[model samples]
Target: MPGPVFLEGEKVTLRPPEEEDVDLIQCWMNDPSVWRRALDVNPTSRQQCAEFIEDVLQGDDGVHCLACDDSAPLGLVSLNDSQYGPDETSRARDTELAYWFDPDHHGQGYGSDAARRMIQYAFEDRNFRRITARPGSFNDASVGLLESLGFTHEGTLREAAWFRGEYHDMLYYGLLREEWNSQ
Candidate 1:
């Protein structure tokens, strides 16, 4: 029962998703390149995207932050679809971390910096014992970023996600609170 969470990093700062971000988010979602990475095929209209953002802004289950710099929007980072651990063990407190930066902003370290900030918030502020990130096996950049953040590659679900044409393996990475704190 702590206060709300706001994450700020070296190259990027994460704020609550805003109305203005709807347009940019819509563009990202509609882009085939971005959607394929997330295994999203159905097209969402601008209005649907706006409504989704509104829903996200209203919810409290997880924190969804818009990663940005001084000039323009970079991408989104969210600790979403959280499921509390049934018991008191370490696995009982964890959440799923998801993030994406515009393809144009790729390789600038924004995604990695933003993810590091979010994971920090998850452990120190949210009291989560662990955080899990699932990225497609073909998404080398995302996998590398997660690995760079000290997320250990736990497992892969073979042909679990269908994206452009064929099914792709889904890779899951995990980082424990204590492990991150030790780093």
Candidate 2:
């Protein structure tokens, strides 16, 4: 069975990963349609998926959740400590947002709903001052989603990422708690 719901949204529920979800997670991790835009493009084995679940269960530093609706899981959403500086102390008040959904579920508003909830949790519940997201320049959907969520285009790292046989730029976006509250 899936783990308990960690947060609920209009169209999705965020839950911690369970051991039974290893196969599905591994499948998503290895899917080119999903990983092509993600930072880590390497394929994930079932064992690695299980280990990730174990780490999450054992109190990992980040909040990792599976986005699910009534019937099944649609994707993964996470708020990890933003490594924006040379040390942890410099990034204590920031978190980085990341998510990916099943290709079949794209453009259905689930990703937006899940991401909105995670942003709320980061800023309001977790007391984070800012949340950041770095999407590849080629990922139009991701860039659009981040923009639609009230994130500002902070900057871009030109040719900072290598994927799909060539280098791609990475777009940086940030939303402060004040900005989110004002929206």
Best TM-score goes to which candidate? 2
Q: Candidate 2 — which residues are off by over 4 angstroms? A: 56-58, 84-92
TM-score of each: 0.90, 0.92
Which digits, one per residue and each the tens of the lDDT, describe model 2 over residues 126-154?
A: 88888999999999999999999999999
Specify the poorest-scoring 10-residue window by lDDT in model 2. 83-92
Task: Spell out the clash pairs found in candidate 2.
Answer: none
Per-residue lDDT of candidate 1, residues 42-151 (tens digit):
89898999998888754665778888886477888888755664333545688889987789999999998999999998888778888899999889999999889899
True-vs-predicted CA distance for residue 126, candidate 1, Å? 0.8
lDDT of each: 0.82, 0.87
Off by over 4 Å in 1: 1-5, 85-91
